[model samples]
Target: MAAIHLPRTIRIGGGVLDELPEVLAAAGLSRPLIVTDAWMQSSGLLARVEALLGGAGIAARAFTGVVPDPTVTSIDAGCAVLAEGEHDCVIGLGGGSPIDSAKMIAVRRDRTIPELKAPHQEDSPGLPIIAIPTTAGTGSEATRFTVITDAETDEKMLCAGLAYLPLIALVDYELTLSKPPRLTADTGIDSLVHAVEAYVSKRANPFADSMALSAMRLIWPNLPRACADPQDRSARAALMLGALQAGIAFSNSSVALVHGMSRPIGAHFHVSHGLSNAMLMPAITQWSAPAALPRYAQCARAMGLADDSEADQSAVGALVEALHRINADLAVPSPRAYGIERERWEALIPLMAQQALGSGSPANNPRLAEAGEIEALYRQVWH
Candidate 1:
């Protein structure tokens, strides 16, 4: 059996964020550091949390410097703010970027980015993290991994292990009610990719398959609804749970080529994580489906794109067509439309491929891609 791991506590529902105070008190976590981005701080969500914590007689301070594609310097700045406080725990409040930054800061408060990147057994535990996700993607809240970009090298480091896992995750769909159409679409697709990849990963096991299939069932139906109308509370809740389910699925089974290749784009072009994953998904699925026809067919069935009686080949083709249609419907831009210049993208293909390979994620891919193959695929997607 593959070792199963998850957050110690997971509270999932529409009004779940309202239970934060009771959750914190039960865990005996007071004087915590709230990790988030500038947009979150400015949006009054931070103040709302602070008021809630203060009302509970818990002292907290906000570290709102986390940027998209969280960097080593940003983690360092967060650590500095953490060091200034007598914080007992860390609250990762916002999207994946902030949650990931909090995880790095929790485990590497006293170490450098290079040291943090290196794999090692953690003897002492990092500070307990209570994660609250505002976005329906990244699954950082349930995973044992955190991706932090190197400030000097522009490489996104996939730091993993128990040290990065959160103690608790609060899943509140209400937080996602205000997400813009673009964000809703991107994150929703990201969740779909996670479930699909997890189910097809080389590390796939029965436990992971269960979660992945369930995630696909939840997300595939509601993703477009949530994107079309952000105020659709039922759709929001379904997508939120779907993202959480996929997060748990990928955390244990691991994300493969789509994520392996996606990280480099985020590190280099600063594309949002979900969008990059979306852009790579169709191409990579086409390349890898032959390697796992039955698995991809099951995925198509799980997404309700194909019935269970369909032949594997037909299902696989439907899967690819569905992905393309989803991208088009979501208004997802191609790399050209996304503003990545042809010359610069071509120049960086080799480097991006190298970085993607270095992350070790592609090894979990059903169709493991060589650096040359990855480069060619990267080249293909540039249009």
Candidate 2:
């Protein structure tokens, strides 16, 4: 049997933020907790959101301390605010961190103890959540997964369940207009990896495959343009939509090697999720391609690197080269170049590989890799 899940309502366009009141009304939520980050608070985006909600006579409380790679402590803190305010809904109004934090907060709101916050343990229905993504990465707005760091163990907990999916998603491309070039590139590449991994996953289904292919086609051509010129609304729009589509695809089908490997790096080294994904993407793809040639070739064609006459292997090569070119154009720095010491990175390889395996994402890959293969891939990225 095939199971596909998505949000009930998705509002997208240039000024979709204006529709939040009506969305909340339809959902019967009048008081909401606005979860965001300090950056968004400082930039007045949170205020803008509050004003819009206030204009519609909706009451909201703001909790704006979510950090990148949201930790369990952070979720608990936000949940405290939610409990105190007696919020009926949650508006996640930033990038991945805040959106992810919001999901967890909603899930854990009824829990009086912290021990019950583990994945699949909290069985209560979460409050209604409306995700507003300011960045076109992570697609947390559309996904059912919420990654949070375990404060005690310093391990990233991949908490996932249908209850975590947002009730509504508001994707407005204008919110991403201020993203710098490097962010555009990193997040755009992250979205691309999500789509490709979803397509090549052992769990890939007909529905996810369609969404993944469509996301890749939309993102590949427009990411560079968006990176080169952040003011290009059309390019930003395509990238935003592509990221959300890829999120929905992977949320149902699962993310494979790259994400499995990427999460540990973020947990241990404090690297951004997208950047860590960027670091391992090329190497992981190269390693996994042979096991899923037809899917890789399909991805190549979607990226416009394949012709009917070209061999599948040749097209895969072209695809890899094209990715390298995009990395160069975007100035994606290698892990070594990004300044992690050789000895330290080498020391953590075994542990990172173990954590990656424990995350269960690699099991979903078309080519399920053992710990040794993951370690080898990590070594390959060091150089």
Candidate 3:
């Protein structure tokens, strides 16, 4: 038996952001602290959103100090702001970084990273969160997971539990309209990885399977189209919905090795999360395919890379090829190509492998990996 979890409220589509005030009112939320990055702050999107909230008679303040690959330090700053403002609610108003920062700020209760990392984190759910994502990637608006980096250890901590789940998600595809081409590619691949990993994870169940398949079906054909032409409204909407559905699926069923392995790279290399996942996808899938041939075939069919008439083994091969093609088209570089020096990468390999194992996500992989195997896989992705 398995349990399912999700945000209670999910408002989707373009121009749906105009309804944020009523959504907040229905939840009895007032005085929201909008956590976001500097880009949103300078771009006037923050001010515009503030105007909308004010017009709705809601009192909200913006906390725009967050940064990419958010650190414990950043979360502490957000927490201080939240504490000083005496906010009654939290609104994660950017991409994954700010949303994750918001989640940590909401869930922290004098708990250190070690304490929170424990499988059993006993604490109140903290402030109610209403997430509004500007990017089509991360699906952070709808998930129970948040990644925060530990400045001291340089480790990306993957925190899970219902406490981090947002109470509401307001997804407006219009927000993603201005995202550049590279971002569109990276985030799109990340969403695809989420759906595929969830569908094949050890904890997967029928309900999760349905969501994962749906996400794959939506993301596959449309991600490239959206990447090529940012003005494509329908493609953008489909990608947003796909990212959300993938977030929901992975939240319930959990992610496997690709995520487990990808995190350390993001933490150590300062590489973006989605690009890290994209970098590892092909090699990891090729190595893990034998353990779940049929499932990989299903993913191939979902991605439209293989058909029902294909043999399972051939379908798996096609899936691996497709992942490579996507990465190439997206211009995702390998660790070496991305400019991580060989000496530094060599030194970090052991720690990266250890961190991935400690994350506990790799344990859910269809074919469980030993640390040695993980180290080898890391080497494979380097060049």
Candidate 4:
């Protein structure tokens, strides 16, 4: 039997951010340490969360030290803040970085950073986390995983298990209305990758399949609209729901090669997670479709790129083309175009490939690759 895990509570829709006090009360949490980034603080979203808490006689504090691809040093700082307060819960208020920071900070109690890395399942509960996602990508609100970076080594550590899962998710599509086209594109593509990878992963289960397919259906159609017009509430709502579903899908079934390979690019070159995924997606999917033809075909169908009568091989081809088209249309730059030095990228391929394998995600791919093959794929995508 397949196992499933989810947040204890999830609230979705427009203006759901206003329900924080009631949600906190329901979870028996009063004082919260809001974990967020400087952007959130400057944008006044952090204050809004604090105001919501204040409305219910609940006092809250905030740590706005989060950075893109959250680093262990940042988490340590957040942990220090958490220690200073009697925060019954941690409210993660921003995108994936802040939410991930909140998750890590809540559980970091006395352990060293390396102690929380994958292959070490942190099943024991930490301070409860209430995730408030402003972006429709990363789906950090619904996932049981978090990625933190080691600034010294530039390795993105994928931490897993129940402790990282949020107790509640406040998903308000309205929060995404202010997002610019680039952020919207990258995050939207990130969600799409989550769904696509989860659906094709060897760990796929019926529960995850259902969510993944639904997410694909929603995301593939709505992403462009959301990017073109941030005020498109219907598109925003669809994308928000799709991202949540994709997060749940990947969290349960796991992400495969795209994610495994994407992390190192993010860590080493400081590429955003989703854009890295986009850079590798078309090439990797083309390479992998042969091993899981029917599965890839189904993904094409789910995205409405193919129909029932289409041959699996043909549909898989279409899926690859669609991925490339999506990237081109969204202006996703390749490693070379994005300004990563070619010599450095080539030199790091072996190390990045090794790190990808170490992540345990490539093993979940329908077709497994050794370090050599992964390095070749990296080289292929460089242009």
Report the number of the highest-lDDT candidate.
Answer: 4
Error of 4 at 317 (Å): 0.8
lDDT of each: 0.90, 0.87, 0.89, 0.94
Residue 40, candidate 4: alpha-carbon lDDT: 97
User: Distance from true position, residue 163, model 2, in Å?
Assistant: 0.9
| Candidate No. with top TM-score | 4
* Tens digits of per-residue lDDT for model 2, 1-383: 56988889999888998899999999998999999999899988999999998899877899997998898788888988887887888889988989989988887745533344333544346888889999898888888888888766667878777778999999999999989988898889999999999999998999999989999999999998998889999999999999999999999898988998898888888888888888888778878899999899999998788977788999899888887777778877788988889898999999989988887889988888999989989999985
Which should have the higher TM-score, number 1 or number 4?
A: 4
By lDDT rank, best first, the candidates go: 4, 1, 3, 2
Judged by lDDT against the true structure, how good is candidate 2?
A: 0.87
For every model shown, what is its TM-score relative to the native structure? 0.98, 0.96, 0.98, 0.99
Which residue pairs in candidate 3 have backbone atoms (N, alpha carbon, C) closer than 3 angstroms, thus clashing? Answer: none
What tens digits encode model 4's per-residue C-alpha lDDT throughout 266-374?
9999999999999999999999989999999999999999999999999998999999999999999999999999999989999999999999999999999999999
Backbone clash total, candidate 4: 0
Looking at model 3, report the run of 10 residues with the lowest lDDT sum.
Answer: 114-123
Instruction: Give candidate 4 regions above 4 Å deviation.
Output: none
Give candidate 2 misplaced runs (Cα > 4 Å): 110-124
Report how far off residue 245 is in candidate 4 (Å).
0.2
